[model samples]
Target: MGASNFVQEMKEVGERLLLKLQRLPQAEPVEIVAFSAIILFTATVLLLLLIACSCCCSSCCGPAARGRKSQVQPMAPR
Candidate 1:
């Protein structure tokens, strides 16, 4: 089944990640620092982009600018 194939692929990916983690301890300090710096830089860039998008024109011109108004009105008794 397709699910079984997806599970097998996930297991393979997990194994590969585990092998990489096991090898991490043997890596040089400089390599670790460089990798850490790269990760932090990527995180910073992504966070800045997210903040910029949230603060842009969409918040001013989009549907969010309008207040919710009720559509129903009270009916008179017959």
Candidate 2:
């Protein structure tokens, strides 16, 4: 009974939200394109951030920076 009541309330809220949204002005083609571009850019940025985090989190520092011995080359005077 409680669950049914909760579901009914959610349905009513959804219907009300839909009615409110229907009253809003329709999107112009330019606005639609702009929104699409914004969403695409946001998704791209999120994907890049996820990739960077995955790469960075794999090691304490990074694979290249892991205290490996390197040759100390004397800088040649140009």
Best by lDDT: 1
**How does candidate 1 fare on TM-score?**
0.48
Considering summed lDDT, which 10 consecutive residues are worst modelled in model 2?
16-25
Which model scores highest in TM-score? Answer: 1
Task: Give each model's clash number.
Answer: 0, 0
C-alpha TM-score for every candidate: 0.48, 0.44
Local distance difference test, each candidate: 0.82, 0.79
Candidate 2 clashes between residue pairs 3 or more apart in a chain or in different chains: none
RMSD of each: 8.2, 10.9
Residue 36 alpha-carbon offset, candidate 2, angstroms: 0.5
Q: Where does model 1 exceed 4 Å of error?
A: 1-22, 57-78
**On residues 26-73, what C-alpha lDDT tens digit does candidate 2 reach at each position?**
867776677668669989999999998988786657776777768899
Clashes of 2: 0
